[model samples]
Target chain A: MIAVMSGSFLQRGEPAIMDKFHRTKAALSSGVDIVLELPYIYAVQNSDLFAQGAVQTLHEIGVSSLCFGSESGDISRFTSSYNVLQQEQPAYQTVLQKNLNLGLSFPEASRHAYQQIGLATSEMDLTKPNNILGFSYVKAILDHNLSIKPLTITRIKSAYHDQAITGSIASATSIRKDLLSKGHISETAVDALPDVTIQQLHTYKKQAGIWHSWEDYFQLIHYRVMTMTKEELAAIHGVDEGLENRIKKTARSATSFYEWINKIKTKRYTWTRLQRIFAHILTSTAKADLQPFINAKTVPYVRLLGMTKTGQSYLNDRKKDMDVPLISTLAGTKNPLLSIEEKASHAYYSIIPGEKKQTLHHQELKPPIII
Target chain B: MIAVMSGSFLQRGEPAIMDKFHRTKAALSSGVDIVLELPYIYAVQNSDLFAQGAVQTLHEIGVSSLCFGSESGDISRFTSSYNVLQQEQPAYQTVLQKNLNLGLSFPEASRHAYQQIGLATSEMDLTKPNNILGFSYVKAILDHNLSIKPLTITRIKSAYHDQAITGSIASATSIRKDLLSKGHISETAVDALPDVTIQQLHTYKKQAGIWHSWEDYFQLIHYRVMTMTKEELAAIHGVDEGLENRIKKTARSATSFYEWINKIKTKRYTWTRLQRIFAHILTSTAKADLQPFINAKTVPYVRLLGMTKTGQSYLNDRKKDMDVPLISTLAGTKNPLLSIEEKASHAYYSIIPGEKKQTLHHQELKPPIII
Candidate 1:
């Protein structure tokens, strides 16, 4: 089938080491018939919203089935977990709000809320990061009454947050950490990845060096925080509950991104959550800017990032049946969604420093990959 | 008695070698009794608007006389030039529009229009850059019916655009060029500057190394141009006609800022004008954002950069007569003008790279230099 994945920036608020174009080529070389880009705004966000966007876009494109990697391969468990979250949402949310008010982070509060509600054991076992997202996908599918059936493949090795590679299947986190530490992917890591993927990664490294990290964006964020008033920052999404004051004050004394985050983070916010909020601030994504998309019943359009010959033919056959516009290239498109995508791409490329700028893909100018 | 100068960024859209705090101290040690900052928005504009902002700010602050260096120190020539630009306005504008339609740049068109009007021999002699700015200052005073008396001082040693360090008084352009090319200011160049200025520049160099040029901002500009529509670019103050199309077309293949500018520049727009427009684009200064400030009778406020005790007493004695606010620190100020300044400073610091970020001055957080 098709893979709808993050492009340019990942959920960690860092540039993808292998850019989307090459990544699509790698996917095409393998069994994937097509790969679609989840717009950067959704790509680099909290997993719940990230999963919702990806699944909704896929479902809108008329995909009949969906598959994802998770800690457990049991489809019934994830399905039941979604049912519990949907049916008991009132009780779940009440507990969630209580936990959140007690200064617990979203993930932590979610787990506590699920455990207190005595839903399925699977819902209580929200320890694996992928499992949490796996439930989100199923929930989105059910919530929208989509016909797409869901399946999960058990992750072979390595946890999502594991910083070290384990066996043949390593977490992308470990791979990124290794790439940063070693300044290049090692042969061992290459062996774990598909040949096409390795080749693409190597080519990108040679041309533009390693991609940038959140640290590259720290100065801009620090400057923005320092210059903005607490009220101004408070208006941004996820910057409520006086966190703006903490961010503004911390940004003044802390010299680096990690230091600033560490100073600003409390039990109320996880590092990832704080980073996602900071990413919004760094891009100036206010609540007003995101409210429409967040409240939309489904993603309004499908962006085709790449396609194989067979996939192109399939799309051609189904063109008239498709309800949403499938955007292959952003060149002259004036849709509201594309506008947000353009702004996000601008923010992504602006933070990358040095010769890497030459290799940066201007998302609007770049055409979809065809292999 | 008072010097109004550009802060952080200069007319060329490059960061100042010395930060504003140091520059103000240097001015105080030199002959200037008080130094006020020409806000970054006006500081980095073309000579006409740049002169207008600086002179208007000084006039609003109850300054009785305005003196500036020019190639021709003759006040009658400047006065006559202003009269031709003011009195024969409709004919001058007609000629200006005709010359502009012929694709000459604004400065070039203005020179041609003045010559066609045949007001004075001096009006036709628009060869010197300072003389052109001198004419603008005089015109602004006359147009506003300001009581500020105008005087001119003969420039010494070097021309404004001269790249060579000549005699004991070299152009600031030469000093900046040398600093960029040589990686450090040479002893010979140091001899040309006041001891206080040299000390300040040297201190900043030791702390933050050299400041950045517009090239440091090329990635951001390129991203903005690529993502924005021609209409959006046209909405920026200096971007007009089909120059937006030229910028967009040229930005596609050009690898660097200079290449982009060189490819986009035509007889209709000078490099300086293009740069000023690009600055506006980088700061997202749409026509709507500037219209309010432009329609105001004068700058709404005067910001003090630095002042000696004697200068403080001078301002203190005349404070009651000053029509506009005199802001020394932006700490808690909520004036509309400060909002623009804050945005400009945010844009300024966001482009600075690396360790220099630590040395970046938050304009609002900074107190005035009291020498």
Candidate 2:
């Protein structure tokens, strides 16, 4: 199976505990044929947009079945709920607006909207993180009219965001939380991850090389938020509609990233949404930089991270039919979006522990991994 | 006497050992009538521009005599040398061009130019730090034709930038170096400073509030230097003549400010000049913001950092004759220049140790000292 993964940063808008190379190695040893990077922007984005980017990329690469772990293990329920939301679009939007006006979070408002449109079900819980992403992927497939089929595998063990392990397959969220708190992988967490991944985590911990959280970037973010005018902050991609004023005001006294999040979190904006916005702010990502890609339905390139020999042969055979450039090396690349990803990667390296920091990680310096 | 001092960041282009409030208190207890701030732009600038700003502000505020510490302690020699360089401009220019062509630094070339034009004297040592500033102050007096007499006091005990303690009077540089290296003020260094200054230093050290150097800001600087293109860096003041290209190239490999300095230093730019340039870059000071004041040959305002009772009366008596606004408080101050100072102060607090950090030092929160 091909794996599309976040590189240096992850969906929680923090640096990955392990660097991309180690993560790719983990995937390779775990029997994945290929590993492609989900660009930083998409990787740190909210569930809906992130799903769209991943689904679109996978479809373009001629992947027929898109399978993901979901709590319900029922793909038909997700598709059915997505179809109902699509059929009653105006009614669903009206209810969503009502919920939002009452200061419910986006996910909360979305769930309320689904219920109002008679689309909520026991097997299709949109509030669950995996289910939310699963629904988004199926919706993107239908919206784009692609020929890709959707599938689901049952997620066993701890819930998506739970920090406590419940079974043999602990959630990735729990594993990361444990690793950060204890600074090493526990035996329980080791059981949840592949041996290759466990080994990498252990090595990074020994060297104090594991990245903790967005806390490492809190100082720069505080400086930016404290210094920028409301108008200047309003120019960032996710900042909008008086949110800049709130953030600017709260930033003066908030000493840490967690404090800023707590101070600025309103019922309308969820914790995850604020984290994503801060990721953009930390990188200084402007709205203009993301506009072209947002307007386009297809990703500009399939950036190869790592692949096995079988995967390489398959790519070579399908190279002639590829719709977009398959970028293996960054030399002479003309795409502006990819250039932003390169800049984001450099930003990622800037926060790693000093001894382990490879401060200059230009795209040209990294060759595609082959195993 | 009125003391025009640098604020949070100093002429050496790093955070002050203590905040402005305590520094003002130290100045007041040591017999200074008033302590006014040299706004951030001029405060962190090179000697020539810094002297110009201080002299112009003092002249506008009806100060009659400009007295400063100099190695030579001879005002007439400074005046005579400045006059000869001004009167024989073309001859000095030719010699200056020749020295520059021979790959000498600007200050060195200017000194050589003065000597070539028969302006050198044993009592007019322009190569010394205080002497250079002393000469600039006198030249500014002549250039503006202000009604102000120039006087000099001999700098005793320790030479500027000398880290070794030669006598009871330690240089400010030596005190700062010792404090950073040991994390406390030594009794020998204490003997060199006023009791009030010693108290402040001890308090800051007790709380771990001592700022080391540009090293504290090197990470943010590295991020900016790495991510910014040469064109983007070119917009900063003092970045010119393809220096951006060299800096951009050197930044890719240099992990620290000192490392970058070693790689990028050339014959034309001395280490101090480069430190000042990096100070400007760190604050994002653009050429456009400095052009108006440079072209006008006057500072925008005189900000009152602290004052004693006699100093207050002196300011009151000269209020009608003041050419620029003397700002006692920043609330409702419309000057763009003061805003920059405020931002620079916030940047200073960002690097201080967290527990001792006063992150929200607003203008309204800090009233002028009454001693």
Candidate 3:
């Protein structure tokens, strides 16, 4: 119930209506005892990092659950598969390697291998939706060994990647698309967005989604991959066995990741497994690094998004008995992940409530989310 | 196995490989027997229509077992849902009325009421990737009373609507994004598409996702909703109550279907449920019309996406006992859904092989899937 805020969520981007100060104030306005701000260290990174920062902030503050979304809202299936993944890593590895040997791309191989071991296809087709975010949450929770459970508030109809303006409740891509297409959300499309969230459409769309495409990023990623030596490739997030050479050689001819996968997929190798490998590389994730987080327990913190008046009172009463820190902000930047994420947050918001830079001032008054 | 080929399958949008000539030929090549061409009528429509058409075709030809995807991929969840939906009509009606009283849209009310009554909310989350397809299969199976057993292929990793391309297998949106950015797919992106599929990248990128953003066709849907009259709406695929009015009004403000849903959603309204309404309006389905089919008792035949030599032989040996039509194609049209679907199949291929305006006649050839 404790309301938490990621103050100054965007720099250069529009500032959140309730900066951490406003959000925290708003939370307190509900008559809650106190509001906490997440450290700037984690607030400004990519979504996964953001999720981690937000979740970690709350966990440290002592929260019991982390609600999120997934393509298939079937929690049991998600849990089953997740557990299976944890329990049968060796078998999965065997299948993964076999599929790769058959020339399958990592993603596809992973998907097919999962299916062979009993799972649903298309039902949670990661290739078409916001599955990465879903997985990121799962991975974060698993890696952190948090006691806070994960729940999801399933979203309505909309493909997460759709990059065209259709109606309201657009895919971030669509919102960004419309923003870029007209350099502003059409007057009509505004109703679909919360007043606080609209700048998301206005800013990212106006700057990044409009001016550049994933294609623009491709070459950079390719360069990153190409420049890597064998050791570096092996050190990348998902690199295993001889994949570094394959990626290096493939980088020479493959202009897009899509082309590279087609060259790799086979009967045994599914597209999803290969895609994961690429993701690991793009994010600089190393198996060695990830290995620790795979099954580790994530601690719980109450990083609040928004809370009602009644919710605040609940948090105040409960805070005394909590086992973890009720964190409002990071006291210092100790973790590299947190620091880097904090730095990156400002760059992404260059066009929103257009801040020139990100700041870490103590926030005591800001709130956009309610309940 | 008898292999049937319909000349119009290519026109319906299915890969020619799915056509009787191609499917059966593929089966034959794989060493199967007895490929019958599904009447052109039932072979071309969408899942709903295809279900009806396939059921009728099977009944006429005598077949058994229809396999499909279900989100939970568990019989208990699927069956439990079906039983509840089937038996709780009266309670659902009462809940629907009360929700509508609160100004909730029919779809919103229906879903909310269902959730209130302990129906699973995850099933109601429309943003789920393959949920609609799975639900449709369920509805079709129930309506047709066909003895087809549903089988699901396990999906791993990504959710259906995810936009961020991860692993090696990018979402179709990412593929289209890559295509849109490059005008033509780079070798990397091209490799992501099925090697045999055609491409119409610009069209896909412009719309968002293939077969996903059909808002342009809303005028037709809206017109049908507005002019159809209550009785007609009731008869339409998913219309119930006076939702017809809300749909018409929403259409006026709605720039897109997704927008329309926002205007119309309420505690009772569900997006998929709403989608079903539109689908019904377009297809002209009715509860009573579907009632008899839902009570059917046997599967018609197995629809093959592709098969290997062993797969073909398995079918060949089991054809007679299938107790349904083992069709592959049709020389002429028979069902409206199939016809519509047949015409629409080409849309999915709009971003792969870089083709434009695929012709029906050209859909006849068959090629190995090259697993």
Model 3 agreement with the true structure over B1-371: per-residue lDDT tens digits: 22333322321222232223333334455444434444333343344554555445444444454444444555556556667777876887898889789977544665666765656566443223354445556666676566666555534544554555555565545654454445555776665654433233433333333322334334334433433334445554455567666775565345455577778865565554565445444434455544543334533343343445555566567667655544443234244334333333322222222122123223422332212
Q: What is the descending DockQ order? A: 2, 1, 3
Candidate closer to the true structure by DockQ (higher is better), 1 or 3 = 1
| Fraction of native Cα-Cα interface contacts (under 8 Å, chains A and B) also present in model 2 | 0.31
- Per-prediction DockQ: 0.27, 0.44, 0.01
Candidate 3 stretches with Cα past 4 Å from truth are: A1-66, A74-94, A121-154, A187-191, A199-295, A299-327, A330-333, A343-355, A358-371, B1-371
Q: What is the C-alpha RMSD of each candidate to the true structure, in Å?
A: 3.8, 2.9, 28.8
Question: For each candidate, what is the lDDT?
Answer: 0.76, 0.78, 0.48
TM-score top scorer: 2
* Candidate 2 clashing pairs, residues 3+ apart or interchain: none
DockQ of 1: 0.27
TM-score of chain A of each: 0.93, 0.94, 0.54
The worst-scoring run of ten residues by lDDT in candidate 3 chain A lies at A351-360
lDDT of 2 by residue, A1-371 (tens): 88889876788777777677777878888899888888877788878778878987897678989998888898889888877887899998999999888888888998888877776667677778888888878888898889989999987766888887655778777877777777666777777777888876666555445454777777777765655556658988789868998898787777778888999998887788888788777666778778877747888888888899999998888778888888877666767877677667666677654435653254335777888
